[model samples]
Target: MRKLTDFEKQVIEQKGTERPYSGEYYQHDVKGVYCCKKCDAPLYRSESKFNAHCGWPAFDDEISGAVKRNIDADGRRVEIVCAECEGHLGHVFEGEFLTPKNVRHCVNSVSMVFKSALEVVAPVKKTELATFGGGCFWCTEAIFSTLEGVNSVVSGYAGGSATDANYRAVCSGMTSHAEVVHIEFDPDVISYESLLAVFWQSHDPTTLNRQGNDSGPQYRSVVFIHSDKQAESVNAMINTLTKACVWQDPIVTEVAAFDGFYPAEDYHNDYFELNGEQPYCKIVVKPKVDKVKALFAELLKSN
Candidate 1:
């Protein structure tokens, strides 16, 4: 059992309600399971989540035998609690017709913690890492983040000698770091070779140390392969692209052995998604993102 924070105790133990729409899981949409914050027992599946717009996380159903209902202290509302630990969840309402189920389990986000589907099913679905520097980490991160099997995409710097590298130092072109996106993906769903294809197609690998107007060593086209098998796959793909004359100029993409990666500043993490209305994203990032979505529609996650 996890130690409950003061606020968690207020909600889970004392049966107090959290502020509407203020809970962490109120707007969360990641594919995962939400477990009891007190006992760590699974309580809700992500698929069961819905936008009740009532400021609390709402679900039409609960995991079978996972939740129990009891008369609330007010006697007017029925309260739901974790079946495993009897920790307070929230109220359950019926006959609202929100879904075919006609049921809504209004839940407190603070009473539960989310676990990604990958984490829940890791024993059967192992994940792998792939890192690439196609251009701006912002652009690369956005592109791969939309893929189906991709679990997470992190914007970072790779292929640098410095023990510590920051965006400012790398952008100065003195750090030798290239803006990169570190990807965690389920190889069973999307193979490493499939990711390499996207990396090659997403940017002009032929260009030397530059992508579009973004010029500097920091913007170089590079791959930091984690294994010899990965190295072989990349080399083979490069050879195939060269033979097919995919690009007019010689491919200058640097393929290096996996070293270390330094994550970029927090603000740069989801630049395109968070700041899509910004001028640079509209002019520089959106088109590339759209092009990849169109070209690789089959590989994308279903919305």
Candidate 2:
């Protein structure tokens, strides 16, 4: 079980009441799921939440079998607790007519944690990994992070001879490391070919060892294929693009077998997002992000 603070223990274990309007989620209105703070078991959906004007978070219903009810110590009011861990979750009342359900679950915000719907992807038995280098890692990371099936994007160094690489070493153009974004995605939702299509459109793959004035081997356009299937797919894509005359210049993108990747520094992880106002991000990364959004609106995660 997760450890709880004194205040959380008071409300969740001791059945203590928090002051009205003092909870963090009293006025929260994000579309997502709320889970038990103690056990992480989903207890409510955001759609069931309604404005009760009672200075506490109110939900019209709870996830089936997630919340259990019992008579209060006074034998008058009904108390609700997490069915999994029996943690206190406040009370349930009916006949208020606040909504069609005519029920209100006056829950303590401290008892639950909200997970944004955009962050929750459907469960899959297996997930796939794809890595690519498209000039700046920041640009590729920002673009892929917006895709629905993409589970994660980590900025790193690959295609290098160095046993270990860092931003300073790679930027020096001596490490042979191309800045890359390692992506984990669900192939069932977004195909590898779809990712390649986005990649080809997001950056200039025809320019040799350069992307928008960033000239170095570190910024070279490349793809690291993890399997033979990926190799075949990428080769087919390259042939199709070549026949279609996608670019006036020949594509310089290097197709290489998967190699070890060394993650960049911590601050480099979400560069475009955390440093959007910075001139580099605004000038170099923002345009790629905007291009992906415009060209692949249907593949983006729902807000």
Candidate 3:
């Protein structure tokens, strides 16, 4: 079982309520699954959340069989708890008409933990890895993380020597390393070509060593292929995009052989999701994320 902080114990064990509008997830708007803090059971989808002006994170739905509801001891409110562990999750209210469902799940922010679609690392019987650098790993991570078949998208450095893989060295633009994501995916659910498509469409391959205000060798566009088959698929997709006149400028994206990928520092792995309110995430990552969510809606995992 996951260890709980004092605040979590208060709200989850003692059935406490966090101050309105103070919860971390109260205003969160990212695509991913929310799970029980105590048991890690899947609870809610980002799509089901809406602002109810009630100071708590409001949801209109929960993942099937993930939650159980019962009347509170006072017999005035319905309390929702994690089905697997019976962890306290606040209360559910109905007939509010706040959303199309006409129901609201008033959940404490501390009651659950969010697993952004980009950070899910579910183990599968079969899986494959694809590595690509398309500017900032934070943006790239956000884009690919939502895809249906992707198991996990890890932000890291590649196409560079191991000694200089650290973020500070890469940021200096002296190392050959480029910020990249190592994606673990299931080919049966999403093909390599589809991932490549997202890679190309989500960023400007035309820019040589920069993406918007960010410019450096570390931000260059590159695809590091893991196998001959991956190389062929990437080539074919680039050819198709070229034939369709997707960009006015010639694509400068380099297709390189798979090299060692050094996972980024711990804090950088889910920078965008964990630090969404930061200026960089709010200003740069969110817009790109919104675009990816819209363009690849069908590929996103359903909550």
TM of each candidate vs. truth: 0.60, 0.60, 0.58
Put down candidate 3 lDDT per residue, 1-303, tens digits, no spaces: 799999899999899999998999989999999999998888999989999999999999999999999999899999999999999999999988878888999999999999999986776579999999999999999888878899999999998889889999999999989999999999988888878878887899989999998998889999999999999998888898888888998888989998799999998888888999999999889999888777676545441
* Global local distance difference test of model 1: 0.91
Error of 3 at 39 (Å): 31
Greater-TM-score candidate between 1 and 3? 1
Backbone atom clashes (below 3 Å) for every candidate: 1, 0, 1
Whole-model lDDT values for every prediction = 0.91, 0.91, 0.91
Q: In model 1, which runs have C-alpha deviations exceeding 4 angstroms? A: 1-124, 298-303
Clashing residue pairs, backbone N/CA/C < 3 A, model 1 = 21-55
RMSD from true fold, candidate 3:
16.7
Candidate 3 weakest ten by summed lDDT: 294-303
Model 2, runs deviating above 4 Å: 1-124, 162-164, 298-303
